[model samples]
Target: MRLEHDLAVRREARDIIADDVAIGVGDGWQHLVGRALVTIRDVTDGKVNARQIKERQGLLSIFTDIMIRGSETIAQRVFDVTNGAADQSAWVCEMCGCGGRLIAGNRLRVRCQVCEADEPERERVWREHRDDILEAAATYIRVCLEHSRLFPVYNIVIRVCLDDRDHRLFLDEVHDRLVWWRAGSWIEGVEDALRQDFRRLDFAR
Candidate 1:
């Protein structure tokens, strides 16, 4: 996606302010202005981590009732930064294979109007197509990983358990590989138990 015009303008303003601060345009305000400029720059450049950017942007104040608000606050920021140019349409319907006329009305739900014409059939098809469900799950997981910028180790773990139950041995092997590469630890045994339980299920076979 192209950078938003408003964001570009704000970044330019930040740079100008930073330059002024460097040349002693405002002695006492230098530090505050400089830090603010840096924060803006980092956020615009996608360099600031989510937590840091959230704190800097004061997102907490704008969002109370975290459970209820969902990602609306962040979505609005993204929209604003992109000058309302982000395509908010659902790329594909999880329920049906239909592509167009999918409305993103709620955070959790994406409904395709054409598919809604026969809800029973859509649900039946979705339930019957195990491979399609697995493919969708894998695609969703991949998109999430990419958006979150997750580590390769986590990606491997997620990939191995994408459409299946967690496996301890599988997870342990992933961890071992990471360790061999001198990566950080981030394993949870509960995931392995879940995998084992899933593996034993007849339906999963």
Candidate 2:
């Protein structure tokens, strides 16, 4: 699938992504949430099933959240999946089949650190993920995001892979939020911000 930086291009590209997306519609892009989102869906039921538990019932703000921070490779893959129909992402950069990062600039996109670094940074965008590694490393999956009408919009669902870190979630530099996250909606603004980030991909632009 083609991922573009131009808002018009992205607008047209949705038709292509929607062709593959099972649900279609921007909000209907549930399949893109990936395994992480799936885990969240399974756990919270996205309120579709029933309210069982939450990290908090309120909100907590993290100074920073570069989608799985400290790990550029995973971030790039997430970008590829969301922006490019990169089904084969497999926790690896879908472009070079190596590792990379998600660049948030004029447009949300991903590229290899080795090859695409020289590319001009056009269109205000956001990009992260540095450190260099040779071979593929272990996967570091983060919270699964859900598309819900709930004010928070993006409901985070974390899955424990044998290590669910013992049903706990550790953040980048924000270690304190971890406690607030598992407690319940730590605060509404937090989710609202997250949803805003997720919403970046939902428009014609």
lDDT of 1 by residue, 1-205 (tens): 0112112223444432211111211111222223443443344453222111111111111111222333565444433432221122233332332443333322233335654444445344445543433443334334433454323333333443334323322332332222222112123322222322322222111
Candidate 1, pairs of clashing residues: 165-195, 166-195
Task: Please count the clashing residue pairs in each candidate, in the order shown.
Answer: 2, 27
lDDT of 1 at 124: 46
TM-score of 1: 0.22
Whole-structure CA lDDT of model 2:
0.27
Q: Tens-digit lDDT track for model 2 on 1-205? A: 1111122222333322221122211111223223323333333323221111111111111111324342565445434433343332322432333554555565444456742453443111112211100000001102223332212111232232233322221211122222223223233234434533332443222
Q: How close is candidate 2 to the true structure, as a TM-score?
A: 0.20
TM-score of each: 0.22, 0.20
Model 1, residue 66: what's the lDDT? 21
Worst 10 residues of 2 by lDDT: 132-141
